[model samples]
Structures are given as C-alpha cells and as structure tokens.
Target chain A: MWLIKHIPPMAKALICFTFVLVITSVLIWLLNPVIIPVLVSLALYVCLLPLHDWLTNLGWRRDMSAMAILFLMMFVVLVPGSLILAEFNEQAMLWQSKASIAGQSLNELLGLLSEKLAQWQFHIEVDQLKANILAGLVKDNGSFLSSISSLVMSISSSLLLVPFITFFLLRDFESLRNKSLNSLPNKYFELGWLMYFKVAKQTQGYVRAVLIQQSILAVVAASGFWLAGFDSPVILGLIAGVLGLIPYVGPALGLLPPFYLVLANPEVGFDAMYTAVLVIGVAYLVDNLLVIPLVVARFANLHPLVALLSIIVFGNFFGILGMIAAIPLLAISNIVFYQLLLSFSPKKFTTNVASFH
Target chain B: MAGSPFWQNLFRPDHKQKKHVRDLWLATPIFSGVSANQCQQLVNDMAIRRYENTEAVFKLGDVGIGTGLIISGSVRICMGEKVLAQLEEGDFFGEVALVIEAPRTATAIAAGDTQIVFFLRPQLESLLSRSPRQGAKIMQNLAKVMANRLGSTNTLLEQSHVAD
Candidate 1:
C-alpha cells in the first residue's frame, strides 16, 4: 500500500489505462455475439430517434411510434434486401461453379507458358506449380464459402435483434441517459455527460455519412459495370460496394473480380480487360473525389495515418467487421480521451498550485 | 403508534415521490408552458445530487455549464466572505451559465444536507433540436426569468444610489 501510494501520477494513469484496455478487450471477446448487434442497434436508434420524437409529438404513443418506424424499416430496407439476397445467392452459386472451371483453365495456361519457357532452355516444374496453385484456390474458396455462410447467419440474427433493440432504446432513451449519467460519481458527472454527448454526436454523424457514401458508390459501380457489359453486373457492383467499406484498399479489391472475369473469358478478349479497368477506375475516382470528400471525410475527420493504423489494428483483431467499425470506434475513443484529459488537467493544475503555495 | 399505518406512510413515501418531483419541475418558471410529457422527458434527463452541510456546490470563479434547482434543502450564495442570498426548495441558481460560458460570479454552498437537480445546457440543446416547439417555449421562459432578475438588480442598484 505504501509503494502504491508512492507511485507517480503519470505511472498510475498508465496503469489505469492498461487495465481498462485489457478489460475492454476481454469483454469484447466474451461478448462478441451480442456486441455487434447491440452496436448496430445503437446506430439505428440514433438515426431513428428524431423521427420517433416527431411522431410522438404528433400525439402518437411511444411504443406505437416505435412499431411504426420498425415496420417502415421492414418495407423500405428489409423486403428489398431479401429479394436482392435471393438473386445474389443464385448468382454466387453459378459463379462458384464457373470459378472451379476458371481455376483449371488458369492451371493449363500456366503449364503452357512454362512449357514455352522450357523450350528456351529454362527448366520449370509446371505440374508441381499447377497442383500447388489448384490446391491454394480450393482452400481459399472453402474458407470464402464458410465466411459467407457465417456472415449470412450473423446478418439474419442482426435483422431480428436490431429492430427489437432499437424499439426499446428509442422509448427509454431519456431515462436510460439519465440513469447512466446519474451513475457517474458527482465529481465526474458533468464532464462525463459532456463526453457522452460528444461521442454520440460524432458516431451518429459518421454512421449516417458512411451509409450514404456506400449507397452512392453501389449505384455508381452498378451503372459502370452494366455500361461496360460485364456479366452479373448487379452482383459485381454489390460486391464492390460491400468491399468498399474498407478504406484505401477497398476499391482495388472491388476491381479484382472484373479483371478476373475478363481474363477468364476468351470471347470477351484482352481489350475488354481495359474496359473493366476503365469502369472501376472511374468509380474509384468518383468515390475518392466526390463521395469521400463530401460525406465521409467531413464526418470522420481523423488523420489519414490514424485512420490507416486503426484499420490495421482492428482488422488484425476482428477481421472485416472490425475494419468497418474502426473509424467510428476511433472517433468515439478520441472524444472520450480528449474529454478525460480536459477534466483531469484542472485538478492536476490545482494540486500543483496548492503544492507551490 | 409504532405499528400504525400512518407511521409507515410517513417513513416510506411511495412511488408518488416521482410524481412530486415532476410537479415541482412543472411549477418552476423556467419550465413554464411545457407539457406534461415534455416535463416528464425533461425530468428524465435531470440528475439529483446530495450535498453535505457546508459543502460547496460550486466556488466563485469556477466555470459552470448548467443551472441547479434546489429540491429539498437550502443553499447560501456568497461572494467571497459576503453572503448574498439564501435559497430554498423550488429556487434555482447558476442559470447565467445556461446562456453563456462564463466564470461563476458567486459560490453556492449548501446550508445543510441538501438535494439539487441539475439541468444541463447540452441536454436543453438536444431537446431543442429534437422538438423545436417545446424548445422555443423553454427559451422564452428562460428569457422571462432573466428579465425578472435584471429588473430586481436594477431596483437594488437604484435604492443603493438613493441611499448614497
């Protein structure tokens, strides 16, 4: 106890930060299943709260208004989503079969190239290389299929959980906020409440802006692909849009499917590959120049390095979902950290002043 | 009398205590013209604080962000060593911070064990954005409260000048 009492303030702060980080990481891992749904619901609640308030002001009961909003979401978002999912599933199955055939063709092409090089006195193990390539493709495809299935399961569960959670959140928002604020010790109460509002505002803006950006990009990608005469333009565009959730590298990933599709089809020829590149290039340009500058950049407002590092760190731990969640999480943590610094500094300065006196 | 129902009722105030809080908020001039639902909503965002005897609610020159409504005890407002006023239940203080960011002009110390409810500026701003009509009413009410305080201050100044 004496040693602990003798520890420097900076060291104590560091210890506290490390303890909090470790506990948060453990809690996230343990509550992984519920955490995503809860987070998504919170975002939805923020977006829908204004509308819910308006309705309630118009003399509607809280629960009734919440139910009305949920039904509106079902019709406007979920029903169309179900239709799109059905169509995408059909296209995906077809693409999977075609992918296997394409893999074989790639193996043959590699073999032919290796043979041609051998005639020039360069020896290469074409068979071994082709076998290895095929094995890798099969393994990758297996993992991809598993990941997709898991994603679908999680999404379906979220669909059920989101509205249910959002309803309660909207109805009890004021009381819930009060309860949370009241729980803070009196010394921290005012600052804690301010931090909460700041974090909420930042996160709500970020989530809404991201959703708008994604939708615009999806439409742009679909139109570009369709105009370029790509097979399954809708699915390819949707994939591009979804993958575009990752910053920096996302558009590049979105470009790969079209490149592969063009390369694998002999009838389309090499010239079509340039068209595919042109379409994706245009989409990428529009996304970065227009959508990002106007929407995401305005809302997120993080340093590029910080954004990139967050994506790398979060992606390492939580994969694609973490990559998508990284920006908002960083924004929230930034607000909380700065507010804590502000709140603590005055106390520290007072202590120093007293010591000097 | 020890086992009487009235004794039990006196010791344990029922859930009607919450309603009493709502009624108290309703009677405040700052919340004038607000509907019952709006009152309930406002109350939901407020937090009650308890202060021990002689405890400082806030010191003079400290930065503050909201006003405090006295609920169950008295508080003494002071400027340095001089006591300016003693306020009891239903009275509010620190309202100047709600309209502007400024250092507090006076210290507010609880005269006894006291309970106060805080209504923060940010909470009011959020309410404004969510419901403009109700927000307008609150702003108008705040203006009236400030105007009345200004009038009283002018009267006090005039009386002091006459004495001089």
Candidate 2:
C-alpha cells in the first residue's frame, strides 16, 4: 500500500495507459462480430437523427418515427444496393472473359514495345515480363474474389441485425447517452461530456459529407461515361464512385476498369479509350474542384498525409472496409485524444501556457 | 420506511417513470408552456444523478456545460468561502452555462444526500435543431430567469452602495 501510494506520477500514468490499452483491445476483440453493424448504425443514426427528432416534435411516437426511417432506408438504400449487386455480378462474369482476352493483347502490345525499344538498344525480356505480370494479376484477382465472397457473407448476416439495432438506437439514443453520462464519476464527468460532444459532432459531419460526396461523384461519372458511349456505364460509374471513397489514390484506381475495357475490346478502338480517359479526368476535376471543396473538405479537414497514412494502416487491419472507414475513425480518435489530454493534464497544460506567456 | 417494500415499489417507478419525469420537467420554469410530448423529449435527454452528503456537484473554474435541477435534496452554491445561496427542490443552477461555453462561476455542493437531473447543452442544441418553436419557448423562459437574477443583483449592489 505504501509503495503504491508512493509510486512516481509518471509510473502511475504509464500503468493507466497500459490498463486502458489492454481493456480496449480485449473489448474490441470480444465485440468484433457486432462492431461493424453497431458502427454503421451509429453513422446512420447521426444522419437520420434530425428527421427522427422532427417527427417526434410533430407528435409522432418514437417507435413510429424509427419505423418510418427504417422503411425509408429499405426503399432508398437496400433496394438500389441489391440492384447494383446484381448488375455488378453480371459485369464481373463479362470481365472474367474479357480479362483473358486482354491478357493476350497485353502480351502482343508488350512484344511490339520491346521490339521498338530494342532498336533504341534497350534490352527487354518481353515474354518473361508478360508471363510474370499475368500470373500476378490472376493471383491477385483470385484472392480478391475469395475475399469478396467472405465479405458478402459477413455483410449479409450483419445486414439482418442492422435495421433492428438502428431502430432502437434512433428511439433510445438520448436516454442511452444520458445513462452513460450519469455513470461517469465526478472527476471524469466534464471531460467525458466534452469528448462525447466533440467526437459525435466531428464523426457525424464527416460521415454525412462523405456520403453526399460519393453520391454526387457516382452520378457525375455515370453521366459522363454514358454520354461518352461507354458500355456498362452504370457499372463503371459505380466502381469509380465507390473507389473514390479512398482519398489521394482512389480516382486513379477508378480509371483502371474503363481503361482495361477499352484495351480488351477491339471494337472499342483508340477513340473509346481516349473518351474513357477524358470522362475520368472530368470526373476527377469535378471531385477535387467542386464536390470535395463544397461538401467534404469543410467537414473532413484531415491533412492529406494523415488521410493517406490512415488508409494504409486501417486497410492493413480491416482491408477494404477499414480503408473506407479510416478517415472518420481517425477524426474521432484525434478529437478524443485531444480532449483527453486537455482534461487529464490541465495543470501541466496551464503551466506550459504560463511559461509561453 | 427506507426498508419497506411498499415504499420502495412506490419510489422505484417502473412504468410511470416517463410520466413522472415529464411532469417534473413541466413544473420547471424553463419547460413551462412546453407540451407534454416536448417535455417528454426533453426528459429523455436528462440524466438523473445521486450525490452523497457534502459531495461537489460542480467546482468553481470547472468548465460548465449544463444546468442541474434539484430533484429530491438541497444544494448550496458557494464562491470562495462564502455561501451565495441555498437551493431546494425545483430550483436550478448553472443554467447560463447550458447556453454559453464558460467556466463555473460558483461551486455547488450537496447539503445532503441528493438527486439532481441534468439538462446538457448538446441535448438543448439538438432540441433547437429539431423543433425551433419549443427551443424558443425554453430560451425565452431562460431569458426571463436571467433578467430576474440581474434585477436582484442590481438591487443588492444599489443597497450596498447606499450603506457605504
């Protein structure tokens, strides 16, 4: 007891940090199954909360309002999602055949390029390079296909639980929040309340902005591709829009499918490839110049480097879903960490300020 | 009475809690003229906290973000070593903090074992966003409360000057 009481403050802080880390890791591991649904519900709840409140203010019952929102989601999101999945599956099969044909063409193109380069005295092993590239592509695609199927299975199972969880969250979120707040001890109450408010505001704004940005990009890309006479305009547009959720490298990745399509189809011609590139270029311009500045940048406000690093780190841990969620998660953590520091070390913080002054 | 099951059941309030909380909100000045449904919505955002005797509700210089309504006990508001006021059931303190981000002007301590309901600023902002009319009513009431406090403070100041 004496030793414990006499422990250095730095040691005590280290112990506290370790304790919090262990607890967080354990909780995350235990709750991994439900985490995605719960997080999705939270995002949905933040987006829909104003509507829910308006309905309740109009004298509609809480349960009734929640039900209305749930039905609206089913019609607006779920219906269209299913349609897109169906279209995407059809496109996937078509692409599988086209991919083999494209491999052959790629080999021919590489051979011609290698011959031209040989005239310039640049030695190149065209066949070996083609074989290595094709094998790598096939392996990557196989892994991606397997991962996609497992992801779908997990999502389908969790989708069943989402609506139910969302309803309760919408109906009872205020009470639940209050209950949580009431449980905080006096020492932590102010910090907890501040952190909760900041994190919620930041996260809700980020998610709302991202959704709006994605939707607008999808529509614009789809329209541009369709007007340019690209086959599977909707599929291409959807892929572009979805991939655009990743910052920095997403737009470039979005260009690949249409580029591959142009290369694979002899009928598409060089004109079609140029048109595809132009359309993607226009979309990229609109995204960076208009949608991002007006809709997303104000809310996200993340440094480009931070956003890129978060995508890499989160993508490593959670794959595609992690990459998609990285920005908002990083924003929340930043707010929480800043608040924690302000709250826990006010004296030291004040002393530093005083010294500066 | 503390151990009596009948008393416990009466106080426990399983089914009637919502109605009870709504009624309690209705009796408060800030919630007056608000509809029962609106009151219920407000009540949903309130947290009920229990404090032991002599426990601090809030300390001077702490960041204040909400108002606390006395529910079943008394609280003493103090500045430095001087008691400013003793508040009882239905009285509220720190209301100005709910509307503005600032530090607590005084410390509030429970005079006895107490129950208080808190109405936090974020919830109030949400209420304003959802229903401006209801939010306006509460804001108007809050304005009146502040005006009344200012009037009293002015009178005290005037009296002090006259005495000097």
Candidate 3:
C-alpha cells in the first residue's frame, strides 16, 4: 500500500521531466536559424539601454537618440570588429592549412612507428589505436575551422539585420513591456512582470560585469603579446578579447595559438613561449583573483558548475550564442522553470529563491 | 560602484500604503495642502530622468511636453533663453502643459549631470483618473503655483514702473 501510493508521485515526476526536456529540445531546434542574430540583438539592446535612459533624461528626442546610438555601435564596435574579423578569417585559414600539413606528417610518422612496434610486440593493438587517435584529431581540426568560418560568414551577412531590430527593440521596449504585462491574465500580470524585471536585471548585470572583465583582460593580454614580439599584435589582442568571453577554458585555449606561433618560429621560440605563459598567468590572476569575485560574481549569481553546464548544453543546442549566453539564460530559466514546476505541483523546493521572483 | 552586491531590502507589497501626499511637510509652498497619499501617488507615477553635466534637457519652445519631478537631481528651467530658475530635488515644473495640454512655454535644461522624474501628459491623465481625490489635491497645488507666478509678475511690473 505504501509503495503503491508513492508510485504515482514518482510516475508524475518522470512524466514532467520528459515533458520539459521534450519541449526545451523542440524549442531550441526550431529556433536554431534565427537564434543567434536574435540573441546578439538582445544583448546589444540590453547593453545600450542605460545610454538610452540617459539620453531620455537629457530630453533628447527618443527617436533621435536611439538612431544616434545605433550609428555609434556600428562605428565604435561592429565595423572595426568586422575588419578585424576579416583578418582572423585569413589567419584561421592559414592556421588550418599549416596545422593540417603538420597533422598529416605526424600521423604518417606515428603510423610507421606503430606498425614497427606491433610487428615486434607480436600481439598488440598499437597500430589500430594510433590510427584512431590520428583520425579523431584530424576530424576535430577540420570541423572546428569549418564551423567557425561559417559562423563568421553568417554573422557578417546578418550584421545589418541587428541594428534595425535593435533600434526598434530599444524604441518600443517600454511600451511593449507595458502592453505585454497588462495583457497577461489579470491574476498573473503583476507577478509575471515582476519576474520579468528580475530576470532582466540579473542577466544585464552579469553580462555587463563579464564584458568589463573581458575588456580588461584583452588589453592586458594584448600588451603582453605586443611585448613578446609577436606578429599581428593587435589581431592577437583582439582574439584575446573574444576568447576572454569563455570563462575558465578560454584563457587556456587562448594560450595555444600564441604558443604555436612562437613554436613555429625558430628565432623567437622559447622567448615567445615564456611571454605567452606569463600573459596567461597575469590574465588568469586578474580574472579569478580580482575580476571574477569582484565583478562577475555579483552579476552572475549562479555557481561556476552551473555556468559551465549551461555553456555546454546551450552550445550543443544553439552553438556560439549558447556558448556566450548560457550562463544568464540558465540563471533566468532556473528561476522561471522552478517556479512553474512548483506552482503546477505541491512539491515546493527548499531553495524557493531559485524560482521565486 | 561596480560589482556591488545587492543589499537586502524589505519588500513593500503595496508601495501606495506607505505614502499619503496630503500630509506632506516641505519648504516648497506648492505642496502645502496636498495629502500624503496624493504625494505618494505622484511619486509612484513619476518617470525617471537622468543627465550628465552640460547636457541640455530641452530647447526653448520645444513644446513643454511633460511635467518634471526633481527626483534626485537638478536642472535649469529656462524661458525664452533666460535662466528663469535652477531647481533641485522635490521641485517640479512644466506641469502647466500637462494640466492644460498646451505647448511647452519654456525649455528645461540640465544645469549639471542630473536626474529628474518626468510625468508625461497622457501618463498623468491615466494616473489622475486612477485617483480622483489625489487629482483634486493636484488641482489645488496648481492654483497655488499660478497665484505665486501672478504675484511675482506683479512685483516685476512694480519694479519696472519705479525704474521708469
């Protein structure tokens, strides 16, 4: 009798879990095409809202101010960013070509060694294992470059689309919010709006803080690279800025490229390696010791494990945008999803704050 | 103040309960008779505005479109390019336009990097409709303001006559 009673609850929980997972998967898959641009526009709108509020206070006409800010974004960030990205495109292609040659040479060398070792060892699987490892590495490099280039191309093509949507978003933002809030079922409107604001405030705060950390790291890393006698110092710096977005693994990944560039050159090899290592050290200390705790910790209220998981899952579903946005979106979803789960059932969670606005 | 953790705050389920505008006591002659509830309602309805130093709020005759509540900042209310008054927190102006739905008579500019609460005409209309008692108190407040302006005009006229 006791087991029977609990079975229903267990079954209900399983059903709910399946239902949520299905819905989330469907939503992410269906929204895949427009997801990135929409997300980028969302971020742009959020970052610029403070400026819009300032201009409104100055009593500059809203339309005029919004338009001016749009142009400013293009001039100050996007255009220069695109030009720099073009250089990265060329560099990425060059790196792939060289890395492929190196990879193939290494694979052949390994194959010969594995074959010789297998003949001598009598009954070993060395050759097969070597082949598997070589295949995996080759597959990874090819896919990585292809995916990155496609992303860059898509971003550039859709670049014009962002400002148009962003301007409208900023312009009609408040009125749209009011209408949406008011139109919700009367019983839910106030709570829903409160939740909306809370999520927005938290997400904005986190992104702002993280972006500041990225910029500071970018400058510091770039300066280190410049001093290291690296070619394309500015480009390396810009790359550092973008990589700085990826939290823990970003700095580590960033170290590889400069390290390789140094390794490839004979004259500046050891010195370059040492400098790149130093750059990563300084960057890591700045981020973890001071920046992460002081800046990102306040805004991004979720724990690091949660942050990392969000990036992995979201990136799996939505690619780059997911990678950039996983933390904030997860934080928001954690609250909203938990609230929905609780309200629809009698099982209230201990951490009510996670879901309650 | 970057990266500041959120300080805990007590949540008021209903902000309106905490204020009664009519019971207000302040140095400004304009709000003398208003109730605490009315003042609170006005504060709730007030729109936020912010500006940096040397930023202009509005140009003269740009249709004094909305009322302002000096929420936590200051500004210069100019008339035909003359510096008519420099107002600070708790001060309000351009209210006449919202009352009568008229073009702005003066351009209010920010004297320094400032923040103000703006009350647009349509929003004010909705707010007034929401509370008739508060609306009446605001009308009374407006009458006192008009009387003060008239008394100032009369004094200016008397001084001009003496100079002549």
User: Top model by lDDT, which number?
Assistant: 2
Error of 3 at B75 (Å): 40
lDDT of 3 by residue, A29-121 (tens): 897787667767877887887788678656676688889888997888688768877887787666656664545444555566778887898
- What DockQ class does candidate 1 belong to? incorrect
Candidate 2 lDDT over B1-164, as tens digits, reads: 56332233224433456567667778888888999977886775566666778888887656667888887789999876888899998788888777876667777999987777778888788878888888888999989877777777778778889999
- lDDT for predicted candidate 1 compared with the true structure: 0.71
DockQ-best of 1 and 2: 2
- lDDT value, residue A188 of candidate 1: 55
> What's the candidate order when arranged by decreasing DockQ?
2, 1, 3
Docking band of candidate 3: incorrect
Question: Could you give candidate 1's per-residue lDDT for residues A1-357 as a string of tens digits?
Answer: 999767665566556556646876898889787886787787788778789978987889888999999888878767777777777667556655666565666666777788899899988787787666545333364343334434544765567677778878888876767776666655556666666767777677767766667777888888988998888888677777766777766776677667556535656765776887787777778778865676556656888788889888987777667777787777766666555544444332221110000
Distance from true position, residue B99, model 2, in Å? 1.4
Q: Order of candidates by TM-score, top first?
A: 2, 1, 3
- How good is the docking of model 2, as DockQ? 0.22
Which of 2 and 3 is the better model by lDDT? 2
lDDT of 3 at A319: 60
lDDT values, one for every candidate: 0.71, 0.72, 0.60
**Between candidates 1 and 2, which one is better according to TM-score?**
2
